[model samples]
Target: MPEYPTALGASSRDSITLLGKDLATDVMGEVGFGELAFWLATQRRPTPGETRVFEAVLAALADHGFTPTAIVTRLTYLSAPDSVQGALAAGLLGGGSRFLGVTEDCGRFLHEVLVEREPPAGDDGWDELALEVVTAERAAGRFIPGLGHHVHKDGDPRTPRLFQIAREEGLVGPHLSLFAAIGRVHPRVLGKTLPLNGAGVCGAALADLGLPLELLRGFALLARTAGLIGQLAEELRHPVGNDIFLSVDLNNRSVPPSAQGGPHG
Candidate 1:
């Protein structure tokens, strides 16, 4: 027989263990989902402050009202009402560069920048470093991750709130310090101010929490899972999927193939 080792969860005939604790007696009702999630990822319990910041990140990413992911989820549910899992999976599959994936992208990007240098001494140093980073990225023709938002051109409410929460918790580590500096200084290089979007800020906060850079997107997805469920529930009550499908289906006009290659061509 072969043995597989894991510190996560194990099951026996009569009992179950999670993170080395009895799942039913120790984990259930004793740990909140957010804390349990944090524990599951890092295999160590988080402080109360860490839990608050982490849960805040989860809340920040949860739902954004009629996003493509929500739309796809509702549409998938409409198409296959028999398979709720399929609907959820459809939405989760949409977590990519333009959407929830920014959480991971920003975290990894900030981590990479931090790995190359020491922590800045203060906001002034961070701003100077951010200026250098923005200038280099501009020269390279690369967009700074977590810098802009499509909807909240003025500002992302979640961004500042998350920053405040992290600050209050004394959890503003180098990643967040750098991200905030970027928010303040990027306009000098980019020639315009852009709101530091919520997803990007969540990334920074998670990075500051020392969460795995690779699993940053996973956290975003986890948050959005609740949102997707809400979408599906609202879809049942309000039922917009059909109207959405019809709006596109009825409005689209058939045109001849263009000189440039097209999907039909």
Candidate 2:
């Protein structure tokens, strides 16, 4: 069984081992929390420089306004106090797929495209092989992954930045180049240039960074959870809020209640 380096030791309450480093801190943000977070995941305790990178990432990904997931997180907090974790969890579920799930698929695609090449095929061959693989996969009842996004018809801006960072870190290798080759081949659908989205680029970058496939989503969850908390906190601050707006009956249908529910007279 292969172990996940990114997920060596993660506990719900405190501590996680990143890159052979042990990080111990309370759940609440405290002094040197950022340092602790980096140490936990990357081992060897983060240098001031490394800690700076981690902080930048944390801040950049912390929150986006009124995204459905963000909105849901804030709304959850308005009605129920002490559910910050729960609200964050809900948002995390939506995001993990795009970050980790998509990354895994993109990595797979990148690897396949590389394997399918013979004798260092040129750009044309890379595209040709990718299209062939995609068509064959679709024919085999598998959808081509990391090719589309719900929000952006043209492209995902975040994708390039992540790739650029990974490249600067010397992490992008054959795996990423393979994915880039494929990404460039995608002709615009709906008259839109569908560039590699967050999932695709992150997927390739993580693979090149030597992260395990199973641990991709977990890392992403860890990162984005920070943002979710911020949204929850912001929503809680505003007083004018109709928090409990559950339209249970708006599209509700009554079902037979049995063991779970006592008789309501």
Predicted model with the maximum lDDT: 1
lDDT per model vs. reference: 0.96, 0.59
Off-target runs (Cα >4 Å) in candidate 1 are 261-265
lDDT of 1 by residue, 1-265 (tens): 9999999999999999999999999999999999999999999999999999999999999999999999999999999999999999999999999999999999999999999799989889999999999999999999989989999999999999999999999999999999999999998888899999999999999999999998999999999999999999999899999999999999999988788787666
Tens digit per residue, CA lDDT, model 2, 1-265: 9855454455545666434444344333443666666555544455564454444444434455566567666666665767767777667767744443565677666666665555245667656665666556656876556777777667777767766665566555666666666576545312334566666666566555555566655555666677776666666676322543455436578878776577673
The lowest-lDDT stretch of 10 consecutive residues in candidate 1 is: 256-265
| Overall local distance difference test of candidate 2 | 0.59
TM-score of 2: 0.64
RMSD of 2: 8.1
Model 1, residue 232: displacement in angstroms?
0.4
RMSD after Cα superposition, model 1: 1.3
